[model samples]
Target: MTVIGWIQAIVFFLLVLALTKPIGSYMFRVFDGQKTWLSPLLRPVERLIYRIGGVREDEEMTWYAYAFAMLAFSVVSFAYLYVLLRTQKWLPFNPQHFDNMTPDLAFNTAISFTTNTNWQFYSGENALSYLSQMAGLAWHNFVSAGVGIAIAVAVVRGVARTSVKTLGNFWVDLTRCCLYVLLPISIVVGLYFVAAGMPQNLHAYQDAVSIEGFKQTLTGGPMASQEVIKELGTNGGGFVNANSASPNENPTALTNLVELVLIFLLGAGLTYTYGKMVKDTRQGWAIFTAMAILFFAGFMLAYWAEAQGNPLVHAMGVAGGNMEGKECRFGISASALFATVTTDTSCGAVNSWHDSFMPLGGLVPLVNMQLGEIVFGGVGSGLYGMIVFVVLTVFIAGLMVGRTPEYLGKKIERREVQFAILAALVTPVLCLVPTAVAAIIPPGLATLNNGGPHGFSEILYAFTSTNANNGSAFGGLGPNLFYNIVTGTNMMFGRFAVAIPALALAGALAGKTSVPEGPGTFTTHSGIFVALLIGVIVIVGALTFLPADSLGPIVEHLLLLQGNTY
Candidate 1:
């Protein structure tokens, strides 16, 4: 709302724009199997990993093979994390001696992390020991993100390579993603976080006496390492209950900006990576431009709505922005920016509670997720998700022009369009069906912490978050058996259902030869296409979720204007 806030937001986007090329070019080399500066150091480790796993690095996989490898890897990751959570009390790093997670919570937590959802059903500091934090959760933060990037690279190969039956090997892409990309960047960012005064230790909770003579237990753990990747990888699970809002995790304002950059870093970079792979930098910029527009629009709406404050409070002659659920250090602008940024990607880290935002402000984050989180999206997920829309846009434009649709010389046909539509429809099915069932069922209703539309918003937000693979919550919904089981299932479906079909689309595209572009061919990198892409994304979200959104945040906003509170 303030000029300083506007300046900060502008500067943040500029920096991200600045970073897209360098980081993205490096990633292109990594995934394309070219040598980089890290090659000397990481090459041996990479080879050792393949040797131990008995993987053939020289081999490539068909689309089905790649999909199967991804699924098998996820299965192992889930089993490892689930067992680790259920047995962590007896594990080595139990400095706090926290009890083991129950089977249901463990099931949910494991699925949550492996799918890169990071949705927490319990407080991290209280429910997790040091070992669980590192081995169980942080491990997922690294690998799950790697998996997303790997899948995206596979999709790129499909688009870039013509008449090729093979995409890159899954193991090689996954390995290189971690070694050359995630690990090195994470080390640098993690040290900056530790310097910012966030905790990085194995010490147990300290017992302290307050000045008021009340006893308090100060929480501490291996937070700095987790904090960096939590943002960098767009896996936003916190090391504590309060998440980034916790001083021990986020610390200073400088750290806040740093974390924001980290959350957006790879996602923005991947757009350029996409361009580099497709042999068209303009193609990447077109997608990035659309994402930036959506992001700024959402931020402005949220900031303005929050700046307007509550009309009821204004009627009582108290006038300032809505600071109800925001930290004073962050103020309205930073809080609003954070909400939009985190939701813009699938990163769920928060500096302020979304649940306490004005109804319209709250609606923005919900809609971002419902739009398939493709507004710059999760690390690898965002670029691939936008590519889905790009396909749809090209198809729509083809219909308008009465010609076969072509993107980057590869014709977009019925098979490719079917796969894209299948992937696009997956999240809506996963989100809406479960949400409706929960609304009518007893156990689902049992999780409500508020009455009326606000309560309905919480339910809708939960399913949307899971279905989008976004982990942030509306905060009021209590954890229950039904939520644990259902949301976990939603998380898995959200991640893979779309991902597998995307890979299939990639394979289908990769097998075809590129056709020559003629005078009638539509340019996907043009301004008209960018506008069409954005319109398709917004319209699809609006038409699909308008009724549900009207019942929740829209109704709530109207009620608040009439000086009513739910």
Candidate 2:
């Protein structure tokens, strides 16, 4: 990649690093029930919400109670969104008079958003009305993210608190997350997006003649508001089919950078929040460092592969980086960076199509999701996901050293280890099993756009993305009844299967007393531990996914080098 591109990537990363502490600290206060600058304004509103919903803000929940609340909330969210999508034609904001979504599509879309996996099968502008966009999808963007953050904070409490059977109040944590964190930030960023030339209106799609003398329908809605949370919440459902790649959604390079930052912002910040909560900033940094290492490695590989372009194309007398799927404004570097960051954090927004990338370039995003997207993962999900691995890492370390493992002074015991292992296995089993079933079936292959290994990659990527709760698509496979149903199932299982187990682990840990550090205690915040953590994460991902990957992108890459195209 060009030097300018490298500079941009470095600056983007540094900006995220720079903002991590303040945001993390602010979030710490928000979740810990402390007052903030916005307390005066939001406190009344927060109280009113609790009153209206009949929520007891002071009520704490056991891990099972917390999971049940999250599940119950999700069920309601799914029903509301499903009904909204299925009946959008009758909805108030149907300026385009868009038809209602089919039962399967609605089912999939509902699960997608509720789980924070905003995987769209239909084009937003063409299929959804403004009411569905805002009242349904955008609302989920805020609350789903809030739920994720809330769960993470609870998990952290499990690690930090001793001899406690209760985590924080789910309703209160979710409320504070939305009020003090998501809402305020979204407002500011939404304003900036409007100022940066992205549209923010409820006007009808304007019909106009282009310079080419063709009529065009310029899509319009409450895009600015949705666009902000779409990234800020790591909810990548685009207002239109083009997603962030669309000019109407992401208008400029600066906007693109900002979207990238927003995706990683809270995720990176949560590392610090974890550190602060655990009374060890270094622990958070150690996790941050491991994530950073993976982030850079993925970005560098993607950038390099994209820069190398397609050798087959080069044989045709073309040279320079592969710009096939990338936007010219952002070029290879920025697009690669965006892909790396989005996939890393489970934000599926794309400036470029992964399917158009060289096989190896496309492999980066695939592998990112397969690694469970814990490299600065989605909002609250990333921290908890990483912590799952951390638990496993320390357990493995404990076994090696012939001592019980301790994390932040809490013993990582049998129940915790079992739950951690269960959480870790969710991705591989949910992803690979469905992928295998789809690869050979007629219904699954009906929409396949490419053949051979590349086609296999597309299927593999779909299952991986959904199972990771990462909504980005690799393209090629057209969404059909089969995909909608299958991926929808994957999304639900991926989200709750992992989350409930994590909460269970947290609950188990919460009931335990903290032990004093002994000579046998493995220091978790050390460089050696970071290295081990990375090793555990990498090894687990590699062992589970490598064979499937070898059959898809890896084989495709080798084929491409021999001037073959699938």
Candidate 3:
């Protein structure tokens, strides 16, 4: 709302824009198996991984094979992480000697990370040891993100290629993505985070006394490394439960800026990568522009709402914005920007609690996720998700023009459109159905941290976040056995349900011959197309979620205006 906040938002966006071309180009080369600056260093390592795994890098997979590989990897990852958590007591680097997780919590944590949901039902510092943090959770952070990027790359290939049997090899894309992209960037950012006063040690908890003589035990571990990838990978799991709000996790404004850029870095860049694959950079920029438009609109609303402060506080003669659940170091603008960015990308590492925001302010983040987080979504997930809308947009245009739809010269036929709709509906169905079941069930009602509509908002946000593969919580729900089991199910299907269909869509597109564009072909890279794309995204979101929003945040906002608090 202030000039400074606007300036901050602008600068953050400019940085993301600046990064798109280079990152996009690099990813293009990496996936295309072309040489780059890091080729000499990483090529051997990449080869070694393929060799050890006995994967034939030269062999291509059909869509079915690729989907199988992705699902198989996720299953193995979930199993490994589950075992690690359930048996963490005997693991090394237990410095705190934390007990092992219960069966349900272990299952939830494992699936959460494997799906890139990273919804931490337990506090990281209190519940996990160093080995579990690094070996179990952080390791999943790298591969799950790599998997997402790989899937996106496959979808791009499907759109870009013609009459191809294979999209690309999932294993190769996964390997190279981790080696050539994630690891290098994480190293630089991790070191920088360490230099920024974030912890990068294996030291145990340090007992300390505050000025007021309160005993405080400060936890430290391999945080800097996890912190960067957590943001960079859009894996929002925190080394501690405080997440980005903790000083040790996100120490300085410089680090804050870095984290924000990291969240959008790959997601924004992948738009350009899509353009590059499709041989149309403008196509990528169009998508990027649409994403930016949605991002700024949501951000401005969130910042404005937060800047206006709470009306109840104004009635109490307090002013200067809603700082109730925000860290003093971040203040209003930074916190608002962070919340908006995190939800915008499904990187749910929050600096401020959404539960404490003005209802309208909180509604923005909710809507962002509800819209499928396609406004600079998760690293690879965002582009493919938006591409779903692109298909829908063009299909609608095609229906209007009485012609078959084509995107990137590939026909968007009944099958492709069906897959797109299926992918798009996955989150809404998972989020809403489980949410309804929870609302009426006793165990579900027992998890309410508040009463009335605000309580309903909390439950809604939980399922929405998980179903969107966005792991942010509404900060009141004590998600226990039933909640964890159900949300865990939501996370798994939330991820693969869309992912598998997207790969299938990519396969469908990959096998099709490119149709020649005529005057009647809806140009996808124009202002009109961009407007159409935005309209489709918004209309779908509004239609699918308006009723839920009305019941949750919308009702809560009206109640708050009448000086009522749930």
Candidate 4:
């Protein structure tokens, strides 16, 4: 890595780390009904929303009722979005006269965004009206992100509470998450995006006379609002077809920096929030520290790989290492490094294309996904995943020491550890096993856009994408109905499977009796524990993925430089 890259990485890392504690503290307050200066600003808006929407703030539901309500709300959202996409030509503000999406495609798109998968099989403007862009898609971006945050809060509350049957009021947590945390920040950033050149137009998509005199219609939207939360929530769907890399969507270097920061900020802070809620700031920072390490490591490797130039081109005397998939505007270092970090965290808004990556460069993202992205994985998802692993780490440590693991003075017992293990382990189970099955199935090889080791990589990537609930695709995979069914199943299992257990684990921990800190109490806040936690994270990822990665990237590397076709 260049000195600048190192500087960029370090400066960014510390900035994120510094923000995590206070933001996390603020988040805990938001969900738990604490106050900040921003609360007053947001509170009236909160009341207005409840009054307008018939949201009963005090009408708390039991866990089942809450879960059911979430499902119902999401279902309504999916239906509305699906209908909008399927009939946008008739909808107002559709200056482009976009055609209706195919039923399968519409379903995929709806479920994708509703689940916060934000998977785009179709381009935005070509498939959606401006009204749908704001009402259907962007609105869900806020609510979906709020849902994930609320779910995480519920789980934490479960852990912090004692013998509590109720995790929390779903309506309350969701409202506060949107009102106090997501909305305030998003509104400010959205305005910034507009000022930076992202379109906030009521104007229709119009035919633009190209320099070549070919009339190509241009697409624009109320992109600024969606663009803000899309990154902040780690929901990677793009406002335009080009995603974050879109000229209008992310106009300048400063906006680019803001986008990157937004993608990671909440995830990092949530780690500290976890620590704070548990009364151990050290624990949260440890998770954040580990994520920082993995992210930078990938960034360096991506930069190096791109800088090294493609070996195939070297043999053929082509000069560039790996710039094929990257936007020339961004160049190698910016493209590769940004992609590495983005994919590393399950924030899949690619500033560069993955398919065009030099084999090894592409492999980094694939492997990062397989690592379960717990190194600050997705926005809310990533932090929670890492914490789940931490719980398992302490549990394992406790087992080794013949004493019970206690995280934040709450004993990590059989139930807590079991659920934590479930949260940590299930994604891999969904990712790898489905990958194996998909690869062995007769139809699997047919999905590949590139053959040989790269083909194998595509199958692995597909499973990783689905099970990670990340909607980004390798340009190679033909994610047809078969792939869709498989991937959608993966998305559902990947999301709900871990989440339900995590919430359950939190409740279990809360019910447990606290053990006072003793000499043997395994101080999770100490630097030593942070290092150990990182060790545990690395070990889990490596041990699980060693062979799979060997078959995919490691072999692909040998094929690229060593001159093997397969």
Candidate 5:
């Protein structure tokens, strides 16, 4: 990576780590109902929010019940958002005279956003009105993220409890996730953004009369409020179409720094939270470190690839290499590193276009998506993905040692491994199957804005973007009804398919007693195990994508970079 890219990434990592511990610690208190300075302040509001939302504080549900509640909640959210997007023209604050989104487009968006996928088939500036943007899309950002975190807390409860019938109250977990963790962080970050000059108004869209006489129209909303959780929740959708890459939206360098930090804050903090929840902080740190190692490795590779520049450019005596799809001002180093980090983490905000990236540069993102997005993944989701790797690693280790596989205090039985296998395999099935089907279909082929081998990459990216629920796109697929319907179905499976099994496994683990941390207790937080964990994750990814990647990015690069036209 360039010095600047490394510097930016390192700075963001340190800052996020620093902030995550404190906030995540406080969140521990908030959810546990432990006394804290803000307990008096936030507790009343928390209680009131529960009452208003009709939350039953005393009620807790089993794993199945909690999963049901989550699905039901998402279903309701999808209905609300779809209706809003379809009827937005008549709602209000639509100064652009924008019409309703198409039924299929609205269906795609409703699913994309509510699942924390944030996948975009349609342009935000053209398709959505301010009312729908704020009330529907932005609101869902908070709720979807809340769902992820709630599931996380519920899973933690399963780990903590000793064969309890109930996991935790779904309503309570959701409330704390939203009110205590997401709400507070988002507000502070949102206010900081407003101070940094991002728009924060319910005002109608404005027509800006620029000094250079360029007629530029502006979109404004309760943008700051939405932006905080959008990053903190790992929900990468932006209030405006440009997402975080837009100058006005992410105005200053400091704002960029903060946004980067926000992307990882919870993900890093959740590590510590895991340790605390399981009464084994080291385990959390080990998993967290493993994720960190992978992230930095990607950051470095992305930097090197961009620095190599395009051989195609070099052949033409172009001054710069690897300039394709990158902002001239952001430069190769900054753009490449940012894309890698965001896509790896399920924080899909992009500073550069992915479609125009050089083949290897593009390959980094594709591999990240294909890897189940385990590198610092979504707030709750990334941690879960890595844990699956941890299980697989333990299983492999157990076979060698002639002992049963175990993690933390729980024995890793066939049932848990079965679920882990499901979690591990779910994303690939969603991505590869849809990609294969799309590349053959007339509509999917028609969706390609760019043709040839790279065109295949666009279709692959759409399924990748949707299945992974990482919103950033290659910016080439037309993604009409056919693409949307197929991709949306995959997203539902990709998200909940992996998650439900995770909760089920957590309960299964909870039923088992924590065996003493004997000499054999695998130190998941430390050196050898961490390395092994990463190796296993990489191998899994490589095995899954080798054939398909050869068809798309690898071939595209060979043809394009070698100066041969198909």
Candidate 6:
């Protein structure tokens, strides 16, 4: 709305754009088994890991083998975290003396972090010990994100190589990703955060009297370290309940800017990495262009809606933008931008509450997730998710032009198309179906804190967030057993159902020999393709979720115009 706000948004975006190629190129080298600057230091550590685990770094895997390894690792991770959560009372670093989680809550929390969803049914400071926060949740954050990057690398390899039965070794890709990329960046960022006033310690909570004479318990633990990877890994599990909104987690404007940059950095850079692996950097830019277009459009709409504030508040003689649920330090523009960026990817760490936004403003975040979060989505998930739409876009283009669809030289045949459609369909089915069930059921409605359309939006947003593997919430819903079990199920299916099919598509593509481009072949890296890709992504999302959205935010917006409150 204001010039300064616009400048902030522009500068943030330019920073991301400037760093895309450097990060992308580095990631490419790291995954391609080429030496990097860090190899001298981390190479020994990386080799030691493989040796201790008895993993054969040189051995490649078929797509099925890769998926199996991923699934097996996730299962072990889920069980390990589940046990940790259920037994945190006995674990080390229990300064707060938190008790163990109940069975269902443990099940939900385990699956949530394991799937990289990080949905919290309970507040962190109240429920979890420091050991669970670090060893259980933060550990999952690193590995889960690494898994996503590995899967994306596999999919890219499928496109880059010709006549190969294998993509790459999942273990190697994951190990290198964590060792070379995530760990180094996280360390540097963690240190910067600590210097910027975020806490990193093992001290007990401090009890203090506020200026208003109220006693307050100040939560403290190993926050800066978890906070670094939380955004950097696109894992949004907060060490504290207030999340990034808390000064302990995200203290200043500089820290906020860093968090925003970290959220989009990997997702955006992966487009370049994709192009590099595919031997065409322009292809990456085209994908980046489409993502940027969607991201900017969403941010503009959110910022505008938040700036307009509430008509009800305007009639009440208030003259400024909606700041009800926003931090005064960041104001409307930054809050809206954070909401848009966090949902734009799967990084759901919010500096403001989406539940308190204008209906249309809240709608922006909802629609972003429902669009499959491919607008510079989660770290590894974004690239593969966009590739899903890319496959569909090329298929539709081929249908229109009366030619076979080909992408990166391989034909997008029935198998690939089917797999793409399967991946694409996962979101709607998981989101909408669970939403419908929750809307009518007593157990679902028992936790309702708002009435009518806004209430409906709460339920809709929960499922949408979970299915998108996004962890932010509407903050009104009191998640119980029914909600916990259902959302956890959706998160698992959302993460794997789409992933398996995507890997299968990559495998199918890898087996095919590259076809020479002909007169009828579609050029995928052009402006036309970018436009078409955007159209397909928007249209598909609109057709699938528009009705559900109408029943939620759209209807609520109309009612608000008539001076009605939910």
- Per-model TM-score on C-alpha atoms: 0.99, 0.99, 0.99, 0.93, 0.96, 0.99
Report every candidate's CA lDDT.
0.91, 0.92, 0.92, 0.76, 0.80, 0.93
Best candidate, lDDT: 6
Tens digit of lDDT per residue, candidate 4, span 47-137? 8888987888777555556566666777788788889878877878877667777877777778777777776767786667787788888
Q: Of models 2 and 4, which has the larger lDDT?
A: 2
Q: Give the alpha carbon lDDT tens digit for every residue of 343-400 in model 2.
A: 9988898889998888899999999999988988998999999999999999999999
Q: Over the stretch 1-566, how does candidate 6's per-residue lDDT look in tens digits?
A: 99999899999999999999999999999999999999999999999999998899999999999999999999999999999999999888999899999999999999999998888888998998999998998999899999999999999999888999999999999999999999999999999999999888997899999899999898888999999899988989999878998888889988999999999999988999999999999999999999999999999999999999999988988799999888878889999999999999998999999999999999999999999999989989989999999999999999998888899889999999999999999999999999999899999999988899999999999999999999999988987999989999999999999889999999999999999988788999999999999999999999999999999999999999999875
Looking at model 6, report the run of 10 residues with the lowest lDDT sum: 323-332
Off by over 4 Å in 5: 208-213
1-566: candidate 3 lDDT, tens digit per residue: 78998899899999999999999999999999999999999889888999999999989999999999999999998999999999999989999999999999999999999999998899998999999999888899899999999999999999899998898898999999999999999999899999999988897899999999999998899999999999999989999988999999988888899999999999998998889999989999999999999999999999999999988889988768999888887889999999999999978999889988888999999999999999889988888899899999999999988988888888888999999999999988998999898999999989787888888888899999998888988878886799889999999999999999999999999999988888877888999999999999999999999999999888888898899875
Q: How many angstroms is residue 159 displaced in model 4 relative to the true structure, after the best TM-score fit?
A: 2.6
lDDT of 6 at 103: 95
Regions of model 3 farther than 4 Å from truth: none
Select the stronger candidate by TM-score from 5 and 6.
6
**Residue 223, model 1: Cα distance from true site in angstroms:** 0.1
lDDT (Cα, tens digit) per residue for candidate 1, span 262-348: 998999989899999999999999999999999999999999999989888889999999998788777899889999999999999
lDDT of 5 by residue, 355-426 (tens): 878777888888888887777788788877777788899988788789887777678889988998998888
Q: Give the TM-score of candidate 6.
A: 0.99
Which candidate model has the greater lDDT, 3 or 4? 3
Query: Model 4, residue 63: what's the lDDT?
Result: 54
